[model samples]
Structures are given as structure tokens and as C-alpha cells.
Target: MTNTNSTKTIAVYGATGHTGGYLLAELRRRELTPVLVGRDADRLRTAATAADLADADIRVASLDDHDALVAAFRDADVVISSLPAYVDHGEAVLSAAIDADAHYTDLSGEQLFVRRVFEDYSARAEAAGITLVPAVTDSNLPGDLLGHLTSRRVDGAAEITISHHSRSGGDGSRGSAETVLASVDWFREGGWHYADSGWQTGRPPVAELRYPTEQPRPASKFPLTPVLTIPRHSAVSSVTGLLPTEFHEGLKKLTADVVAALPATPDPASDLHYDLVVDAEGSGKSVRGVLSGLDSYRDSALMAVEAAVRLAENTTKPGALAAAEAFDATDFLDALAPHGITWRIEEL
Candidate 1:
């Protein structure tokens, strides 16, 4: 929480991954220097070349190595982690950030990891006075937007649903696939218990939803970070989310079709796209906000990088916080519009 007005160095872990590459590029575009970090020196070199950041400093560190991780964060003003969510490495990373007394942020959308960090790590972050922000990407951004709308309209929302759809050309990362599987396991284990005694196994199937102008489309239950975040922000009692069956089915088909598609392999170009539709029902009326875009996975990575830059620059809040709480939803969304994301609000 040392808020000094000066240019600061930021370190990016998993700098070779799909989102990591985009983040590294964004950092360069903003004229901010970022230290690329990963376990593999060769992959780090490849990423540096791909991002045209060959001159940027690079560090090699494994998450299991505490000394290495701490050394990686040394002298850095902020650290952005694009690592896999299920690894549950936030605790260790937070500890390193604390030891280094540097600001920390991540792009994790996993519910269990998020809960653990909020409950167990918040105090340490608060004590260090360093900002530990998580789920700053796809997980909580939609919820933040919905909360902002509800805050202004305050008749109190009854329910909110967020849906995602992808366009024809984009990419997927192995980290994203693993995250999806972990989320499925999370729901299947009766992890999401709503309203006391509402526990159930297996996620619900996508149901048909009617939009203002578009034809009815199927939206299936998808695990999103916002399910845990929106409750902390608005009077809304329930939050539900879905991933387009098109994407899910496509992944399923790919798994069965490609013999080389190992669970550990990265699919950086899966031709994926995504959109989010938030329906707020309150005040005896309902309205919907739709956010559609190409290259959602890449966009999420860019958003995380921007957020880390903002944190390092003292443009956002200090202390441990979630994505929805740390940044203004409208401002963030507006920033992305220039990147080819279409955000629209319609009355229903």
C-alpha cells in the first residue's frame, strides 16, 4: 500500500499462456514495463518474441518454489497472475506479495479459490495495506455492471442471469479448459448451495431465453465468479449464469474428435467467441444489458493486465478486493469498447 507517484515495474506470471501473451502486449502498448515470468525459459522466450517484448526482462519461477516466487516479485510494484485457477495457488502467491509488500491481482474465476482467498488472505492483505484483487476478468465484470444498474434503480432486483456467446474466430487456452472442468466438478459436488438448503448435484441445462429483438435461444447453467460476487454488491437475491451450448458442445466434440487433444495441451485458437446478457427483474419491470464480443479469452487477459496497470498506477483502490469492488464497471466496459466489444442496454 505504498502509494508513491512514480512509474512502477509489474511482473506477469504465466506470461507464455494465451491470455498472458495478450496481457504482455497490452502492458507494452501502455508504455509500461512488465517482467515476463514462467517456469520454462524456452516458453518465456517464445512469448517474449511473440509479444515483440524481447527487450523486456524475463524471470523463471515455479509456483512450488517459494523463494523463486518471492524473488520474482521483488522490486516489482504489482504482480499479475494468469495461472490456472484450480491449482489453488492464491494463498502462496498472496504470501509472496505480502513478503514483497507489492500490490497483487489475478484473473481467477474459480469459486473455491476465491472464497479461500477472501476468508483467509484478506486480513494479511489489509494488514500489509496492499491491494489483492482477484476475479478481475470475466468472472465478476458482468456482476459489477449489473450491480451498478441495480444501485441506480434500487427497487431491488429479484433475479439476474448472465449468458455468454462467442463469435466465429477466437482462441482457447489449456488453462481455460482446465478451469471449465474444475468448475463442472465444483457444481457436481453440490458446491453451490443457494438460499440455505438449496444444494443440488449437476448443473442445470440451458433453458430457452427470449431477448428483446433476437429469437429465443438456449442458455445452460455455467459457473461464473459473479455467482459469488454479485451477492456481495447488490440487493439482488439470486444470480445465475450460463455458457452457450454451442461452445460447450464444441469442446465436448473436440475432446472426442482429436486424439491429440490431451487434457494438459493448450488450444490457443479454438475459434471461440463470447457474450454476456444480464437480465435484471425488479420494480415490476425488467431490463437487459448485453455484452458481446470476439476473442473473449484474449479480452479477459487484456482486462486483467489493464487492471494490474491501474492498480500499480494508483488509479484503483488499495487493499484486498474483488474485481467488482475495485473498479467501476462502466469505466472498464467503456475501455473495452474500443477493443471491439459491443455493449448494449435494452428495456424489456
Candidate 2:
């Protein structure tokens, strides 16, 4: 093993999972090799082969094995975890990363889990001089970035709302399905929105808005991670995100029938489409913006890998933070252009 500062060794926990496979492939495509860490050595080996990382180091460590996980990540400069339902398996991996003093990022979309990481781990990470960021993926960061940038366009932006719509050519991964299932309470209990000089809890009101597309689309209030992530940097007083009603209903159904397995992985060639719209309103002025992207999973991997690389190079700050807080949002978004994602912002 190489010393943490001497090499860019990235350790991937849950490397056998579907999203982890994409992460590994993205790392390799950047000419960087990642150390595969997971509970099952055989499964890790298989995934490594599929990612063309057959000769890369594979470390086995269960979430219950605290010391082992720490040891597995000890020499890594960065650790990217794809562990699903982060509320269950993420804490251990996060602890191990902090113990190793390695930067950490994950594919977490659950609002509560994202908040918990910052709430529970921020102090420890800050003390250890380690950076910890979650929801560094397609599901959250894109909207967060749009909101932050739009807020900049409108001086003294008092409130902001971001509407998200996504369509995938194939089914979601089992890990993603598991995450949605674990978020039942979050959906049921509703979520936090910045307002009245502080955070408040309640469901956001439903609203219909026209997207950049030719026709107006149906949009309703939905609790996505951006509601939590946006307030981390922007001065906006309120943040709300909305999704399609039927899609939100489908998530509720998936939560009830949690046992129904999702497809192992999205089609590699499948195009994941996204429309992110941000509206910021202030005392008398307002601004709106939109970002369209393709291949959610691929862009997510690119985002995570880019974050890892940046953190490894000491370009990002230490402590638990939103993606925009840790990196230049526009630069990060622009970096993924080669991966089939693009964005545009305009005043209204």
C-alpha cells in the first residue's frame, strides 16, 4: 500500500454494487486505479473483473467490523461508498474514512441521511482534517447547483424553488430502490425548508410550472435532497423542490412494496434525462434557470470521481458539506459536459 499523500489511492466501499461498478469504471477511465473494499471478496473480485480492474487491490471488511474497515481505508487518500440505505450502512464506512483521515463522498439521496452525516460527522471530520460530502450525484447536486447559481443572479434572493424531472431509459438499480424504501419516514413526515430566519418543517405546496421543454409540465412539491443541500451555501430563506405527482406516488408505492427488487443496474447505454429548473424570488426581483443532463448514473459517477480527485489533491475543504459548498458548482457541472450533461442559466 502507498502512503496516503504519496499516491491517489481511492478506496471504494460496496464496490460490488451496481453504482459502485460505474464508479470503478469511471475511476479507471480517468487512468486512476481504486482499491475495492466490500464485505464479499468474491463479489468484489467479480465486479473488479467487469470494471477491468482485475489486478486492483480488493479489501474485505463488513460494516460491523469497525477496525477492519478503518484498516481497509487507512492508506487511501479518498473513499467513495455506494452503500445503499445510508442510514443503515453508511455510518460505519464514514467512521472508517474519518479514522483513516481520508476524504469521503457517497451516493446518498435520502434527505435525513444527508442531514445526519453533516449533523453527526461534521465536527469529527473537521477535527480530523478530513472532508465528508454526500449526495454528490445526479439525484441532488444538480438541483442544488442550479439553485445556488440562480440565487446569485437575483440580489437578496429571499426564497427559491427547484423543480426536478428525470426519465431513465431503464429501471433503477437495486441499491437506489433500497434507498427509496428507506426514505419512507422522510416522505411521510415531510422535510425541512429554510424560512422565517430559520429552518422549518412542513410539506411544500404543489405548483405547476413550465420547463424548458416546449410544453408546460405537471409539477408538484416533493422532498428531494436539494431542500437540505441548497441552504448550505445560498442565502435564500426558503428552498423547495418539486417532482411529478405520479412519480412521487410511485415512490410511495415502492416504499410499501419495499421487497420488490429493482434491476441490478441501469443499461450502460441507457440515457438518463433530467430537467432542473430553479426560480429565485426576492423583495422585488426574480430569476430563473434550467439545467438539462443526460445519463444520470454516468454523470453521478463522474461527479463523485471528480470530487474524489479534487479532495485527494487538497483542492477542497475539510468537514461535512454539500457538493456546492465543497467545490465550485459551475465548474463541477461544466466538467461533466464531455459525459453528456449540459446546463444554462438566464434571468427572467
Candidate 3:
């Protein structure tokens, strides 16, 4: 089921935003031209021009413009979405993809939205014969891949913990900030975690964690998309995702003013380093693994593009799927070798 054509046309729904620009640039770097779709024609033009994609095709369509949106994706092989607050905009674009019979992927980190995609749209996508993969970015996939890798080494892996650490100091991308703000109530209400053979609620807030380089920090239990993703393939009885206490508190206190004050662009000179440590324990033994990467946003862009390319080339089952479930863990990480992402499993 490989794509016989030399290039596959990918439609990017939010191709004018910051991360969308990276996706466009990555597509161009790989010589796969993209159809730029966004609400602002001028912003799309400006982004394409800045990315040196002056000749790329551009499509202007709002999410509400279902006819135009469907038309934009009609000729494409896949659609990669960078839209934020996905709970609001995701369904429309996903519906467009299904209507167009195109494979779909996105960078959504919202847990509820992820679950909805699987529950509500999986049957439709399967019937349409198109794959739908949500949470295809760094926020979830890296830890997901590590957890799967760790679980593969430990038989009857009953518990898995994913811890995140980053090197940068300021707020993350604007899309991320907006998503966090949109889901503030969910975060405060204590998000869901997988435990006790089913979804659990109201878990403890924080726990002590020893990172690879830093001392012990009070990591807060943040129910990221991994809680839904990891359990899709692994037989882990429980999964917990945590963020640094400082980062988690800052996210809780994020105001519109703070989001507005965040830099319009990331500091290029200041490298963003992300580390994920996954501990899978069961059957009286344990296995641990670590994954480290630079530039979470750019890595996600690369990941989205790579996943699109692979879907266009390989035979992918049609259904709602997680990143690790959709792609081979080791092969996917190896494909990211050129981007300076590394991982390893350790015996314990």
C-alpha cells in the first residue's frame, strides 16, 4: 500500500501559526509540498513566504466553512492539524478528513478530546477506511513510546509512571498555553488516570521524583494524553503522568495576561531539552527507559510530518489510534534519528 507517487499532498489546517510554520518548513524540507489552509489568507501567505514556500498552494477556509474545508482536503492524501483548543475545532476538521477519505493526525494533548475521538469517531473513521490519530506530538508520543518500550521488557507490567523534565524556563508555545487555559476547569477538577482495572479519579496531586540530572522535585500528577494513549497497547494496570511542580503550578496560575506576555517566538539560541523517564514494574521485576529530545515543538512538527508520510506509504488500519499504537515504537524513534531524539531501555 505504498504511495506510488513521488510526493504526497498533505493539507495543513493551521498552516499560518508558529508550529504550523515549522510543519510547513518540514514538509518542504522533505520535498512534500503542503496545501496551506487557514482562516487568514494574509497570514497564510506571510507564513508561506517566510518559510520560503512562496509557490506552495494555499487554501483559505474557516472551520465553520465545512464545504470549503472539505474542498481544501479533497485532493490531499493526509491532513496534519496544529489547531489548539481541539475540543472546539477538532471535530469539524476530522469530519472533513473523513469526508475526503484522507488520513488524519493532530497535536492535541487534551485527554477528554482524545477520548471523544476514539469513542465517537472511531467507527466512522473505520467505515470510511481512513486512519484517525490524535495526540501525534511531543507532549504525548515520546512518553508513550518510552512506556511501550519499557513495558515490552517487563512481563506483566502492572504499573507505569511517566515523568517529564524540561530545560527551558519561560512559558511554552501559545497553542499549548491556550489549550491549557481552555481546559483549566478539567485540570483543577483533577483529571482522570488509569488504575484499578478502569478509569480512576481524584488521585493525589504531587509526588517526589528524581530526574536524570536534577535533584528531587515535587512532580504534580498531570493527566496528559498519555493516560489514554499508553494503555491502548500496553497491559499496564495503572499509568501516571507528572510534570515538574514549578511548571504545573505555573500552568495552574496562567492568566490571559501571562499568555499575552509570552514571547511571540521561541528563543532559537536557547535549546529546549525534554526528558521522559518511564518505569514499568510488574511480576516481581522492573524495567526503565529514558527518552531525551531537543525542541519539543519542532520535534512534534517532524513527528506529525513523518507520521503523515508513513501513513501515505504504509498499510495503516482505519480507526482511532494512538501514536505508539499507529507506528512501530523503535522504528518511529529511529526515523527521528536525524532530529537528535534518543532513547534507551535499562535493566533494574
Best by TM-score: 3
Which regions of candidate 1 are displaced past 4 Å?
1-5, 168-171, 187-206, 211-214, 245-271, 315-317
Please list the C-alpha lDDT of all candidates, in the order they appear.
Answer: 0.67, 0.78, 0.82
Candidate 1 per-residue lDDT, tens place, 1-348, comes to 443657778888878777777788888888877787778988898888888886888888887888888888887888887877544665677678777778888888777787777777878777776788777665366555655564345365556666655543213555665665545555333244233223233554447765445678765566666666666656675566665555455545343224236534335445555666777777677777777666666677777877887777665555667566777777777887777876777667
Cα error of candidate 1 at position 205, Å:
9.9
Model 3 Cα lDDT, one tens digit per residue, 1-348: 223576778889988777887898899898777889888889998988988987889888899988888888888889998887898788889889888878899888888889999999999999988898888877688778888888878778568888767777535777777777788777655578888767776765456876786788877777778888788888898988777777666766788887777676676776688877887888888887887888888888888999998877647899988878789889998888888988888877
How many residue pairs clash per model?
Answer: 7, 0, 0
Model 1 worst lDDT run, 10 consecutive residues: 192-201
- lDDT (tens digit, per residue) of candidate 2 on 108-202: 77777888898899999999889988888775877788877888877684588877666652256777777766766566455666667666777
Task: Please tell me which model should have the higher lDDT, number 1 or number 3.
Answer: 3
Colliding pairs, model 1: 165-274, 165-275, 166-273, 166-274, 167-273, 206-219, 206-220
- Per lDDT, the best of the predicted structures is 3
Which runs in model 2 stand beyond 4 Å of their true positions?
Answer: 1-6, 169-171, 255-258, 267-271
Candidate 2 deviation (Cα RMSD)? 2.3
